[model samples]
Target: MDMSIVLQAGVATGTALLFATLGELLAERSGIMNLGVEGMMLLGAMAAYWVSAHYGVPWMGVIIGMLAAGLISQIHAFITINLRADQVVSGLSLNFLAAGVSVVLGEGLNSIKGVAILPSFTIPLLSQIPWIGKIFFTNQGILVYIGYLVFPLVWYFINRTRQGLHLRAVGEFPAAADSLGINVYRMRYLYVFIGGLFAGLAGAAISLSISPGWFSEKTTSGEGWIAVGLVIFAQWNPIRAAFGAYIFGALRRLVLDIQGPMMILGLANPFYYNPYFGFFLQMLPYAFTIIVLVLGSREAIKKRIGTPAALGIPYIRGERGM
Candidate 1:
């Protein structure tokens, strides 16, 4: 019942959503909404798990996973960006495609041949501190370190760089950006592909770090979709996404951590002790996602902003729709 353990696990669990939210934010920034995040994540998990089990190189799994997700994203890029298809439909299609393919590919691998987790590291002097070090630094994997490094760099690139401005401009007003000589299609493709890369890493975090092994079942659960919801609550900012992801992560772990107590309390109260109580608690994370989506949309409406202007809208060259 130690608080630190729960907090630590929550933060570690949140790392997957953190990478996912970051990637989605980047893609949305360029006005391309790649909803295939869940599918891409699944493929990445499968790829990483395969490498970890067979190649015996955990870090290599990260690299291969990213590449695999990146490649899968290109399909969406081609359909939506090149073929000018509906982004939502195209992205959703990839979800089914990814789910089926991952299972088929892993059919022969024995579940007993479990994968290994990435090695963990701690800061030299800082890790010796009291509660602070234990909560923030100790007993974390390399991906956590890499994830921490991503926030600042992403913040800088999106807010400070000239290219970042162009990307934003393309998302907000692709027509105007096109008039100003920016290739809207090119920017969209680039950002969407980059988003896939992050999604891939997110998947790797699950198999190679979070769960530390592979099972036959779908690994990500609904985490990818939850990450999609997190973007709105975060108002499309990487820093805010990190905070929201952590909050959601905490909720995810809290259900398990408190299950025994909740179940114990149920012993006295028929409602609390009912077998279905656990299911309700388990649903809390996804339920919160729906709340965020609803409330977040209203808040965005009040502020006159929530998403990129052209988000989920396919860009047809030289055509003005609005």
Candidate 2:
């Protein structure tokens, strides 16, 4: 396979996963575990494809998809954050709800096997650079640019801003933030909703940019799950999350780009007839997560690379719990 094709595939995969991971990172940083990322992404992909197919403007599709996902995720956030419902159950329920709704809606809209896909758009001048230009700039959709732009902004927002500090405080210790006069409920809801929006946009980017005009039950596959794993792997850092996404993205693209090696290794063409290989490839990011966590769980590693102090813990006001 041509190196350019591989590079483009990596870029596309990274872009899609980048959105999902970034969103999840934000949500997690707010002390919310959103296992419903899959659902959000599916809804986003389906909604974006439908809108773009109908409106002839792919970006509009992405916006609509993100909004749809965000709206659905907000329901999850409300139940869990405001009502203090079980976060895991609520998230799982949202995932199922999203999948069912997207499938049914997609069938209704298309009345056929699949939805329409989007086309690529390359910018002038920037797209015309040498080999490096094609890898980073040329012949891609607008979503790619959006992903690149979001990285630095998200990094700055999380590390350098007061709002970001407040968010971190809320995640690390809600009671502390509460005592400090921060509205923990509001911040949690905001991050959760934003995470959903990003996941939705990521899903839309998959339909419009990566796969570009493909819509089926298997459209998102397990990319959302990988995004969730990427959150932990990135340690809630946007730039690191981007790198993690790229690693998984490259692996995913490799499955498509390289086909002959399996046969040479006495393995059948599992890509056909067996969809699990794709899932396994997608699982690599999660596997990496496990390795990192295990290694980092050691005292030596903990001293160097610790988890967020209050990950997965619920915060109650006036509680002395650490």
Index of the highest-TM-score prediction: 1
- The lDDT values for all models are 0.83, 0.80
Candidate 2 residue lDDT tens string, 276-311:
666675566557667755653464366665355665
When summed lDDT is taken over every stretch of 10 residues in candidate 2, the lowest stretch is 109-118
Residue pairs of candidate 1 with colliding backbone atoms: 266-272, 266-273
The estimated TM-scores of all candidates read: 0.92, 0.85
Q: What lDDT, from 0 to 1, does candidate 1 have?
A: 0.83
TM-score of 1: 0.92
Q: Which parts of model 1 have CA positions greater than 4 angstroms off?
A: 110-114, 128-130, 260-276
Worst 10 residues of 1 by lDDT: 262-271
Among the numbered candidates, top lDDT falls to: 1
> How well is each residue in 1-322 modelled by candidate 1, as lDDT tens digits?
4667777778888999999999999999888888889888888888888888888888898999998998889889999988978988998998788767877886765464655669887777777888767766888888887887897789889999999899889888899899889988888888888999999899999888987665544588888899888988888888989988878877888777765443343355333456567788888998889988888888888988768888888777767672
Any runs in candidate 2 off by more than 4 Å, and if so which? 108-119, 123-130, 260-301, 304-306, 318-322
Candidate 1: residue 42 lDDT (0-100) = 83
With a 3 Å backbone cut-off (N, CA, C), the pairs that clash in candidate 2 are 117-213
lDDT against true structure, model 2: 0.80
